[model samples]
Each structure stands twice: as structure tokens, then as C-alpha cells.
Target: MAAAAVSSAKRSLRAELKQRLRALSAEERLRQSHLLTQKVIAHSQYQNSKRISIFLSMQDEIDTEEIIKDIFKQGKICFIPRYRFQSNHMDMVKLASPEEISSLPKTSWNIHQPGEGDVREEALSTESQREKETWLLITKWLRNETEEGVKTWQAQPLLLKCQSN
Candidate 1:
């Protein structure tokens, strides 16, 4: 009974968050996305990161186009998600260049990603030992603190924490 209640609560919270995200006007979303992109690019963590995993934003999510470009301009290795429709699996693959994005086809999710035929290096591979310890997964959401319970999604203007998993 307790498990059922917890599951129901999760569904309700997710619905509420989705509604909140959808409520954001296009202009407001763009404004916030720009603000976040600027902050992430300027952050010391981003400057230090040699390899980073970043998400391709949906229409409702925070835009990451600027950050993607900055990564290439700085000569940092950037990894983006490539979903395998065969199974419910998504892998972080190396993005060769910013220009590579345009030639890629869009998925049903309205995000540009490499097709299944494309071969790229995976982030979890044993190829690079130096990067084994350093990789940041830049997502649309951010946490106030780690190791402790999350305070909120937008807790900080730019929360550039390293993600090991």
C-alpha cells in the first residue's frame, strides 16, 4: 500500500512539472535558455572540462545550441545522445563538429541526433583513461545540492556539477 502511494505521488509530481514547463512562454523559455547557456559557457567547470555530455533540447526544454558551438570552438570533445529505437537505450556519442548537427536527421522527439547507421565513440568506452574521471552531463535540469536531497530543479543560475554516472 505504501509503495502504491509513493508511485501515485511520483506520477502527480511529474504531471505538475510537465505542466509548469509547458506553461513557459516561448520567449521566456528562450530567455532562460540563453541565460543558462551563457552561464554554463562562462563557468570555470565548463572551461576545465575536456569532454562533456550534453543533451539535445526539445522545443519545450532549454536550448543548448550556443553551448554546443562553444564546446567545438574551445576544441573540447562533446558527446550528444543517440537513441537506439531497437531497444529503449540511449548512448552518448562523440559529436565530430557543430556542422554535423545540421546534416543529421530529426527524430520523432523533434531533436536532431545521429541516425542508427552512424558510428561514434561512446562515453562509457575504455578508450580514454584520462577522461574516465572527468565528464559533465549537462541536462535541462539542475539541482541545488548533491549528496543531500535536491532542493529544486532551478536552484542555481548555473549548477555545473560533475556527473560520474
Candidate 2:
């Protein structure tokens, strides 16, 4: 009963926050998103990382397009999660350019995801074993795995958080 209640409360909070985010004006959203991107780009972890795993932003979330562009410009590899419905798993797909993203089909959720024929690649490769590779993650909120063991950055006051692990 206690667990159920906690879960319900969390769902309610998430819904409310989502509503608030959806209500923001386009200009406000763009401005805030740019600021968030700048903050993430300036972070030492992002500066030093060779590979980054990032999510495609939903309509109400902070936009990641600029960040992705910057990553490519810096010659860093980018990975995005591709959900496989049958196996109920996600595979990281390499995105070489922003144009590649636009060319992909959108999922039912309206987010662009790698479909069949997209070149699948591993975020960590054999070469990465020799050197300690840094990782950066940008998201609206921090999760348990990220919070406990990873270095995370939160873009607070704006209500969206970007994590660098």
C-alpha cells in the first residue's frame, strides 16, 4: 500500500510538471533550452568526454539539437537510444550528423529514433578500454543510477536538468 501510494504520487508530480512544461511559450522554451545547452557545453565533463549518450527531446523537454550539433563539431561521437519493441530493449545507435536525425522516422511518441537499416554502433569500443572515456548525458531529471555513481549537472530554476556522467 505504501509503495503504491508513493508511485501514484510520483506519477501525479510528473504529470503536473509535464503540463507546466507544455504550457511554456515557444520563445521561452527556445531561450531556456539554449541556456541549458550552453551550461552543458561549458561543463568540464562534457569538454573532456569522447562519447556521449543523449536522448532526443520531446516537445515539452529541453531541446538537444544544438548540443548534438556542437558535439559533432567537436568531432565527438554521438549515440542515441533505439528501442526494440520485441526484445523490450534499447540499442545505442551512432548519429554522424544532425541531418541524419531528420532523415529517420519518428516513433509513435513523435520522437525521432533509429529504425531498421540505421547503422548500429556501440557507445564503448575496444579502443576505449585503454583510455578512461568520459560520458555526458542531458536529461530533464536525474535518475538513481546517475545520481549515486555519476557526475551530474542540473539546469535548475528552469526546471530541466542535463546530466553528464
Candidate 3:
């Protein structure tokens, strides 16, 4: 009974949040995305790493276009996700350049990812001292298998949080 109630509450919360997101003006959404992108770029996690992984944003989410471009611009290695819906598996595959992003195929979920057969070096399989992810709507700092912490500016998408994060 408790589990059922918890699930119901979760669903309700998700619905309410999504409705609120939909209510946001397009201009406001874009402005927030731009600010968050700048914050991620200026983040120390981004500055020191040679290789980085990030998500391709959805329409309703914070845009990552600038961040991805900046990765290539700074001459750092970039990795994007390739998800397998059939199983609980996701790989961070190396991306060649910013231009290649558009050519990649889009999944049914409307996310762009490399083709199944397209072989790219998996971040974990490589020998790297640091691996980090700047998520679609959140920025996380990870150290190997253990999570160091997740910092999400999306939770409170405001100009005030931008300076601190």
C-alpha cells in the first residue's frame, strides 16, 4: 500500500512539474538555457578535463548546443550517449566534431545518437584519469564508478544560482 501511494505521488509530481515547464515562455526557457550553458562552460570541472561527456538537449530542456561546440572549440574530447532501450545500458561514445552532431540519427525518443554499428571508444573502456558529464539539464562531477556529486542548475533555474554554480 505504501509503495502504491509513493508511486502515485511521484506521478502526480511529475505531471505538475511538466505542466509548469510547459507554462514557461519560450523566451524565458531559451534565456535560462543560455545562462546555464555559460555556467557549465565556466565550471572548473569543464576547464581541467581533456575529455568530457554531455547530453543533447530536448525541446523542453536546457539547450546544450553551445557547450558541445565549446568542447570542440577548446580542443577537448567530446562524448555523447548511445542508449539501449532493450537493456539497462548506456555508453558515452566519443564524438568527432560539432558538425557531426546533426548527421547522427535520432532515436524514437527524439534524442540524437550515433548509429548502432558506429564504433566509438567508450569512455570507461579507455585509460583516463578523469571522466565527467554535463547532463542535458544538469551538470555532474564523477570520479570513476563512484559519484562525487551532481550539481544541477536546472532545479532552480535562476540568475542568482548561476554565479554560485
Candidate 4:
């Protein structure tokens, strides 16, 4: 009976630790979000990237919509990554406009996803001509502190030549 009791206690401790870890993760996400916002805004590459491709943030570290809104305001061509089932890889989809993003499909976790029609064929053609571009993927630290997380943003933006329409 004593051994069983000890085992139960260990399980309880594990559960508590897991819960605390989740909370810490949440806090870290918030910190990274703030820092990433500042970094993306201040980074010269981000400001100069006329046609930028970004992977959608899966973590709470950054909210993709907020970032998109700021880029939209600057009149930059923003492309967010979408999971392509057939390709088994993420495909960057060009957003028609910021106004249409709110209407995107939502997953069970309430994550917004790009619909099939949101992808522009012309953009795909353009992307095919160029290699992968420099991008950012924000990450968080265990302590939830800004600048403590990973520097996912590239220092220099990749150059690509697109055929004129």
C-alpha cells in the first residue's frame, strides 16, 4: 500500500509540474510576441521586403493577424504559409487583402487558416521561379522574457527576381 501511495504522489507531482510548465509556456509566448513585434517592425529587411513570405505562427509567441495588419498598412505584399496536404509541406499564400483575412477558416483550436481560393495562381507561378526567401519564425523562452527567446528573423532578406505581369 505504501508503494502504491508513493506512486500516486509521484503522478500528482508530475501533473502539477506539467500544469506549471504550460503556464510558463503561455507567459513566454506573450513575451516573445511583444519582442517579435518590435523586432519585425524595427528590422530593415522587414520594412524593405516588398514581397515577403512568412510562416504562420503556431505558438502564442506571435499573433499572425496583428503582424499582417501592420504590413498591410505599409502596402507590402504579404504571404502567409498554408499547409498543403498533397505536397506534405507548407505553401505560401498571397493574401488578397487584409479585409478578407478575418473571414478565413478556423480550426478546432480556433486557429485561422487560409482557404483554397485565397491563394493566387500568379503568386504561385512567381514563387516557382525563385528559391525560398528569408523569413522569421518567432520562438519563446522558458522564463517568458523578451530577447531571451530565439532570433528567428533573418538578417538579410533573400533576393528574388519575378517576371513582370
- Give one clash count per candidate, in the order shown: 0, 0, 0, 1
- Over 95-150, each residue of candidate 2 has an lDDT whose tens digit, in order, gives 87888988889887787898866666655543543354536474554323364585
> What is the C-alpha local distance difference test score of each model?
0.75, 0.71, 0.69, 0.58
* Candidate that beats the other on TM-score, 1 or 3, i.e. the better one: 1
* Candidate 1 residue-wise lDDT at 23: 73
lDDT of 3 by residue, 23-85 (tens): 667886787777777777777666766677777878876678998899899988887899977
* lDDT tens per residue, model 1, 1-165: 698898899899878867777877888678778878878888887888788888877777778888889989999988899999889698878899988888889998788999888888776663663346446545445545656774544513343444434
By TM-score, the best candidate is 1
Assess candidate 2 and give its TM-score to the true structure: 0.71
Residue 80 of model 1 has an lDDT of 90
lDDT of 4 by residue, 1-165 (tens): 698898899899768645544554555556656656777777777776666655455553245556677878888777766665556565666777777766878655465668555646333446553653434333333333348674332122233433333
Task: Select the stronger candidate by lDDT from 2 and 4.
Answer: 2
How high a TM-score does candidate 4 get? Answer: 0.56
Model 3: lowest-lDDT 10 consecutive positions = 156-165
TM-scores for every predicted model: 0.74, 0.71, 0.70, 0.56
Clashing pairs in 4: 28-144
State candidate 1's TM-score. 0.74
Best by lDDT: 1
